[model samples]
Target: MDYFDPAGFCKVGDEAGFRNLRAAELKHGRVAMMAALGASVQHYVQFPGFDEVPTGIGAVTTAPGSYGFAALFLVSGVLELALWTEDPKKEPGNFGDPLNLGQYDIDMRNKELNNGRFAMFSIVGIIAAELFTGKDGIDQIGLDTPTL
Candidate 1:
């Protein structure tokens, strides 16, 4: 636990609290990584009818109207409540590797945690850059804006 929380900012005192914190960190990191990927991907690829949707934060609002958001909420709720509910007996973030990549060693896990932390910061930076500059991530980096 010290390896992940050396500064003790999490204020985790016990093993259960540390496990919970680890789970939360893993979830946030996964989300951040996906968000970072989406931020970059949206600039290049958009759905069939969403070509006119402005990239970056604006795209979130154009998510197929209210139904899209509601459906997403429903699906996420199901996933959270049914599929990935926490089990005290299991190790934190030990959700099975469906693909069976077999990279669950300590070194790999540490690498993933580090990468996730970096990704969380990166997504925040990307969103901030987009908000300030009014450009998607790809455009902000001076990449040629490809026609949709």
Candidate 2:
């Protein structure tokens, strides 16, 4: 139920986190750390319950908007991992099961499992984006309906 404090998370930059990485790198390091922590923490703590609802000022003032996207990707990553693990039909050669190429038929479960790896790619992309975008830049990405 606790939210991440951007200021507190970013304190690493002002302290002893990345001394050699340039100013921008240090800032991005803090942002990446905050984004990852915020996403994982918020996903398990508030996902499915508060994701669709608005943050009543207290939450918004505490965690930045990037946390929201991070939460999204975090949930997505979890779901993907779940999908990957839940299916027993998934195998190394079944990667094309989703293609439905004649005998290949089209296994939705296998497809879902395959997508788990793709989802990981997305998670990495989310982290990289957060590093470049900072705390509030996720809002400007156009999904700006504002949930929290």
Judging by TM-score against the true structure, name the best candidate.
1
Instruction: Record all residue pairs in model 2 with backbone atoms less than 3 Å apart, i.e. clashing.
Output: none
Q: Candidate 2: lDDT over CA atoms? A: 0.43
| lDDT (10s digit) by residue, model 2, range 1-148 | 0122355544444432322222233233434555544544443345554454333223443445457657867986785466533222443223344655556434643444345435545446655665566532334254444243
Each candidate structure's TM-score, on Cα atoms with residue i matched to residue i, is 0.86, 0.30
Candidate 1: count of backbone clashes, pairs at least 3 residues apart or interchain: 0
lDDT of 1 at 11: 61
The RMSD (Cα, Å) of candidate 2 is: 16.2
- At residue 10, candidate 1 shows an lDDT of 62
Count of residue pairs whose backbone atoms collide, per candidate: 0, 0
lDDT tens digits, residue span 1-148, model 1: 3446777856646787788888889888888888899888878887787666777887667756344557867998899789998888877887877899998877877777888999999999998998899888999998857856
The positional error of residue 118 in candidate 1, measured at the CA in angstroms, is 0.2
Candidate 1 off by > 4 Å: 1-3, 6-13, 63-70
Runs of candidate 2 exceeding 4 Å displacement: 1-106, 135-140
